[model samples]
Each structure stands twice: as C-alpha cells, then as structure tokens.
Target: MEENNLIKKCQRGDKEAFQKLISQYHPIVHKFLVKITNHEQTAEDLTQETFLKIIRNIEKFDIEGKAKFSTYVITIAKNAYIDYLRREKRAMQNTPIPENLNIEDVHIQVEETVVNKLYGQSILENLEGLSEEQKIAIKLKYIEGLTLKEIGDQLNLETKTVKSRIHNGIVRLRKQLEKGDER
Candidate 1:
C-alpha cells in the first residue's frame, strides 16, 4: 500500500498502520534532530519524541494534502529540539556560579550585565526573524502551554493553522540555534 494510504489508516486508529509509519519516518526524524543538536543521544531521544507525538496526534495529520505525512512528523521533531535547547539554556543559567571562584569579586556587575545583555539581544533577534504568526503561536503554545484549539480561538485561526505556525517557528529557531549564537 502507498505511504499516504498507510498514514490515513493510522489516522483512523489502526495500530499496525501506525507502526509502519514509524518505521518509515524514524530515521528521517533522527537525522533531522542530529542536524540541530549534534548529539547522538539527543537525536535518539528526539526521534522517540517525534514518533510518540505522531501517535498522539495522528488524527491531525493531513494525509489528503500535498504536504507529506513525514513532513508533519519531522516538524514535531524539530519543535522538540527547540524546546530542548531552551530548557538547556535555562538550566545552565539557573545553576549558581561559584562564589568562591572570586570571579564575581573582580567583575561581578560587568559580567552579569554583559551576559544578560547578550542573552536578551540573541532572543530578540531570533524573535524578530520569526513570522508574526509563528511567534504568536510559539509564545502561546510553548510559553503559555495553551492547547491548539485555545490558541486558535485566541488568534482567530484554525487549530491546524496554529499547529503549523508553531512547527514552522521551531524549525526556524532550530536553524538559529545551530548557527551557534548561544547567548
């Protein structure tokens, strides 16, 4: 059977069909994540995330559209990478710097200011690069943890449009992060 037909079957709650979809797309997902995070473990974990997300949201896949089902699944993988990076950066920051290092004594105020300024600048630049719809979708969905339907109601878009915007936003953010401007 054709892949799209398999996807349609999976969307309709066929468990075996879902497995076939996973088998076909898992490698593509892993490779996509490796391109973003450059870590084998991260890519493997993200591949699992992508498949799991697809399983959970298979009904949302537009098997009838020109957009391939694999594209939709990989988009989830890309968003997972962005979410991972943001979490990593926040974790790094929340770890307290050692007071005994005496680095704080020498340049405490200056270092803190520089770090904050750089971080702010990088985030602003990346946000500016995103489309208004993408930025809004990401902010609402990821930051606010709003459901897609809620986001749609708030933004006056279809739920699928909200998901697509969030997916596209994360893909663009992954590209930015891979460029190594980790501020």
Candidate 2:
C-alpha cells in the first residue's frame, strides 16, 4: 500500500491500516531498537512498547508535515527505549542500553540524512547524457574521493584534462537538473 494512503487510513482509526503501517516500519524500528539495546528480546519488547505508544499518539502525528513516517517510528522507538532505561533504573542487570541516548537531537539528523540520500539519488539518476570520460572523471573525483592528479594518472590523461572533464560534467549536470526543476 502507498505510504500516504496508509497513514491517512491509520489517522482515520482503521485497525487494519495500522497493522499495515506497522508491517511497513516494524523491521526498521526493531533494528534500531536492537542497536540501542543490544538484545533481541529487549528489542522485541521495546518495539511492541513503541507501537503501543504509537497507537495512543498516532493521532497527534501530522501527516502533512515534512517528516517521513519512518522518522516518526524511529523517534518513538528511541523514546520507548529511553523510558525502558529509566524504568529499569540503569542498574538493571547487564542491559546494554547506551548511557548517551539523546532524544533531543534525533529528529533533525534523521530527516537530514534521508533528504541527503534521496537528493544524491536524484543526481545520480540524471547522469545519462555525460560522456564516458566525463562520467569516469566525475565518479573518480566525487564518489571515489580521488584528487585530479590521481584520477588523471588512473585514466592515463593529463591532470588539466581530467579537471576540465569533471568541471564540464558538473556544469552540464547542473543545467539539466535546473531545467528539470522547471517542469
């Protein structure tokens, strides 16, 4: 099911829609909890607690907001784990919960990371028209983190030529992306 539709159905209090939404995000929430708690059983318990809180508070989530549903789930999962830590009194036997889980700074970092990844993917998809030389040069410099001299040496070209290829490739990419934005 489409995520927006699922969210809308969930907002309208459909039990089945909430189940589907949980199915979509359960693995991510579980994985994140596992990382924080370092135990499958604890992660599972926290995951359930997270969703229960979701059931109680899902109505307050703004479907039209910039935050993605996954981000919301993760933030809730973190909060659940934090609550677990506090309730169990940190001295709880061998619990691996990190001492430094900061809920205050979680949301912006997750949102920015998602945005950067999707933005980078869009740029990569628009690499169709670049020449083979330009593509290799750009990738070696940007993706592979090679200097111009190193890229030139690898490609058996002069450093100036490598730099020019990368520069022109970026200019063309920029123009194409800008034109795309107009539509």
Candidate 3:
C-alpha cells in the first residue's frame, strides 16, 4: 500500500516521505488543535510540535497490523493538545494574585465557574439518554468542535458516518430537551 511504503520510507529517514506525510495530515491535525485550543496561533504551534514528535518517533510507528497512520498521528496530536492544556492550567494556578487586583475580578471568576458547572451538568444529564456512539460523536463535534473529517479520523469511521452520528445525536438531544420543556 502507498501508506505502508511512505511509513517505511519515513522510518528510513526519508525527509521527502516525511514531508509528504505531514503535508497530507497537517490540515487534520491543525483542525483538531484549533478545536482544542480555540486559538489559531496556539493550534499552529501545537501542530508543529505534533509533527516534530512524529518525526522523532517514526521508527516506533507500526504501519501494519497496529493502527492506521492517520489514527496514530491524530492520537499524538490529541496527546499534545492535552499536555498543552495541563501546562496552561498549571501556569494559571501558579500565577500570583496581585495585591492591587479588584474584588470584581475575583467575583467574575467565581461566577464563571458556577455558570460553567451548571452548563456542564445540564449537558451531561441530557447526554445520559444517548447511546455511547451518539454521545461520543456529539461531544467530539459540538463540545470539542472537531470537523467531521477530523472526528472520522479520531473515531476510525468514515466522514459520512461521523456526520450521520452527529446529526442523529443532535436530533435526539433536541427531542429530549423539548420533552423536558413540556414537563
């Protein structure tokens, strides 16, 4: 297969092969990063980091009987995004509170946390009625903001399947919400 040949060439340190691979998957990975980070610059930076990791660990990549190369690369991208989030969380937590900061800032943070918690709980309660696949598709597409193709890559489904799952899941959620409103 062409993918197998590319993987072999990449493992053998063929920069052209590696470049080809990156060019092919960069959009998918960058789209995924944008969903996670919600910032174009951060997503771009993370995209580069993901490829660097892939280049460094190409030899460890198993092309046959393991996983598709796209899936493997997406996994790497997701892990990199998660690591970035964790680092950001830690940085925020370690940031010192300025003595001159207004009380309104603290109050705003508290309010935001409360709103997020309530919104998250409402979504989770509604999701309880969905099948696992539906729930995952909805979460990845709506909550994570991944495109259909990116979701397909992550879930190992075709883009059409991902679109169907997301559409059906949204319909179900809408019905559930309407029923709740009737009560």
Best by TM-score: 3
Between prediction 2 and prediction 3, which has the larger lDDT? 3
CA lDDT of each prediction against the hidden true structure: 0.72, 0.76, 0.82
The TM-score values for the models, in the order shown, are 0.53, 0.48, 0.64
Model 3 Cα lDDT, one tens digit per residue, 6-75:
9899999999999999999999889877765557999899999999999999999877665788789888
Question: Rank order by TM-score, top first?
Answer: 3, 1, 2
Model 3 collision count: 0
lDDT (10s digit) by residue, model 1, range 61-164? 77666555555665677677677767887999999977677765669877775677567655545765787568757766765577998667645568889899
lDDT of 1 at 174: 76
lDDT of 2 by residue, 1-183 (tens): 278888788888999999888887898778666654657999999999989988888888887886667667766776676677667775666578677978766888777756764677557756646765676578668765779986665455689999999999999999987876675
Which lDDT value does model 2 have at 133?
60
List ranges where model 2 is wrong by over 4 Å: 90-183
lDDT of 1 at 175: 88
